[model samples]
Target: MFLLPVLLLLSSCQETIESKDWDTIEMPRVSVHDPSITSVTEDGEEVFYIFGSHLAQAKSKDLVNWEVPFQTEYEDLDNNIILGDIDKNLREAFEWAGKDDADSAGGYSIWAPDVIWNPNYKWKNGDKGAYMYYYSATSTWRRSNIGFAVSKTIEGPYTYQDTVVYSGFTQVDSTDGSDRNTHYKNTHLKKLISTGVIDEFSSNWVLNSGTEYNTDYAPNAIDPTLFYDENEKLWMVYGSWSGGMYILPIDEKTGIPMYPGVDSENQGLIVDRYFGTKLIGGYHQSGEGPYIVYDKETQSYYLFVTYGQLHSSGGYNMRLFKSDNPDGPYVDMKNQVPVFSSTDQNSQYGVKIMGNYQFSNMNKAYKSSGHNSAIITEDGQWMLVYHTRFTGGESHEVRVHPMMMNRNGWPTTLPFEYVNNEYFVSEVGDKDIIGSYEFINHGTTNDPKVLPLSTVELRADKTITGDVSGTWDKEAQSSFISFVIEDVHYEGIIVMQQDETKEQTKKIVFSAIGDNNQTIWGVKK
Candidate 1:
């Protein structure tokens, strides 16, 4: 009888050791377009915040569970916690760049606001606060101006400060003599001339005198993203389609541009003295929403930008480039430099990190996954935050994906939406990786069409067969994996994550980037 009891106890212990108690985690969803993410400490707890276009804002303690604190509709302006009264408070910006109903029938076209805590910024009362860099645009694509606002807290009733950069100004304005040129001269050029950043006779001093408003050369002056370099120097990268993107060093004390003097020698296409340095995308090529983050481990500055339009049918997708210096000769995985003139296509430029794609398990295919912001968490975890639209409609939702650098020091996102601790793979064995999977090869295309998932099987003999042929292997005692598919070498990281599309079933997944810069993702069936 005692022997029987011992055997029962051993069997129960073995059962307990083999089975896992998976947690049921439900994530709260929010719709915030052009989401710019930042973190702060609130009530002694860490909270992640995302502020986006049209005054939309949301907060979360754990990234999965979000609470939207502000709405995006124009009718809800009064309820906005960031800019309390949009019309009254932002009247100056409206007068400068807001579109009239005759123009677009929309209220103010506020867009792409980025917030950062600036300890160096001293308010009127000598208190420091977070700075909100925002833009206002008229119906005209290039007609916009970038400005800043200040608030005592991250979630703020921010007060407008000043409008810094202006675009789309012409030689003449309205018949009332309030022309764009006059406005530019009085509001911006006078300061630039006074500071010796530009000469009074310089063509750039007058918007119409040169191609300043020309979409082919000059920037659209929107979508501002601020970041600090390794030396803690503050810099701002802003611009959109029409011209390419540009970067300007910021004055940390005043929270404005520290003009890099003038670049009179070479007016070709690259550097601009008054507007700053042009990093990539020019001559009206399709590229916008430039975001840069420095990885300490790789010691490189990664620049991410989206190509195509923002609409659901538009071929909006995220691309990646990197450089040793912040102001860069940024190159893609294929080592191709960004196109400066309209002669070359932008789809052939940057590493197309992700485009529209869908797995077999997904109900709807995701489309236009662009305008992203990435952050390295306090605990050194990298995450990509972006807005993605679906196939059925233009409606969008925010998504967070955990990121990992491959053996080549290139960053690739995991195959699923982040779920707190459920996605962490401590030690994945060969049994976990060898199985049939739904695969997606995110090819180097900047299109709105979704890449449909196909089937692939990983056999015990280290061979892959099905939709594509390949040979796979994993590093001993590590989650890193390698595959040679049809002569292309691919490196990736594998993890066991709960499949959100399937009834939260735990499954193994892999996200890998190929030698040609194309990305491939797999979810085990």
Candidate 2:
């Protein structure tokens, strides 16, 4: 009788273990265009905060579920979140790049603000606070200025400091009483002359006229982002279509740029003492929103930039490049440099990480997935934060995707949206991973076309078939995978995640990067 009872107990325990379900949670959504993310500790709990265009701000304890605390409408600027009285606090910036009316196309024209907790930032009372670097741009693409503000807290009633950089200046002011030469002299001309960028301010040098202003050497002075390298030295990278991207070393103590002297040696890209050193994108190239993150594990700084236009139909997509130095000669996997001296053929440069894509299980396709910010979690897991507009309308929402570094040190984003601690890779066996899958190869084409998923199969005999032909193998007791398809060698990782289109169903997934610098994603079906 005792033996019979023991056997029944063991059988029941086995059944319970097999029937255990994976934890599933719903992710809350918020829309913040050009979202720039950072983290802070609040009340002993870690919170992720994203600050974006139009003075939009949101925070979250878990990366997936967000709560928007402050948002400002374009028409209603009286109740601004950062500036209590926008017309009073940011009067100087408005005088430079304000919209024509309340209902302008740029929506108040404040775009892509990046916030950071600067411990070295000295306040009136000598206490440190958060620094917010933002840009104000007019409807004109090249007309913009980048400024900064300070606050004791992350969500703040910030006080404007000054406009640090200016662009789109001519010999005289515009008809709207916007004096370009005066603003340029007040902000950068003095330094430029002092540093020998120019002998003296003349109309030929100060005036931005014709196609040369947008194509040759003028930086738009927008999309500012800040980061500290391995040495903890602060640096800012900002610019856009007009003259590509530029970087400046920042003074941590003063919370301003420690602008470099003239690049007499004529190094990599041209160095404009006023706008810093050019990284990439010139000749009216359609690239913007440059963000850089230093990965300790890889011992490299990864530079991410978006190409094409940002609208629903404008082929917006994200690309990646890596460098050994902070201010880099960043190169893609194919060893191609992103520096463009002449006309821009963006699709021919950089490692395209993501583009407009749709899975078989999704209700709608995703487009314009660009302008991203990245963060490494306390546990050392990498996560990507960006705004994605879906098809059917211009509506957008924030998405957080977990990323894994491949054997080659390239980061590959997972196939599905991240669910807090629910998508961690376990010790999966070959039998569990062998099945049908929907595959998406994110090509290097920069267009508004959405690539739908195609059916593929991973057989138990280490072979892949159907839409593509490949041989695959998983490392012993590891999530790392190696495969080859159509002469392209890929290295990646595999994990089990929730099938976003299906309710509560767990599925196998994989993300890999090929030697050609293109990324591929798969979702088990």
TM-score to true structure, per model: 0.88, 0.88
Q: lDDT tens string, model 2, 340-364?
A: 8675587888888898998877888
The parts of candidate 2 lying over 4 Å away from their true place are 1-27, 70-76, 101-107, 171-183, 190-214, 265-267
Worst 10 residues of 2 by lDDT: 1-10
Model 2 global lDDT (CA atoms, 0 to 1): 0.73
lDDT of 1 by residue, 158-271 (tens): 777877777666544431112333245544756777778765533543344443456777778788888888888888888888778888888877887876566643233356
RMSD in Å for all candidates: 13.5, 13.5
Residue 252's lDDT in candidate 2 = 75
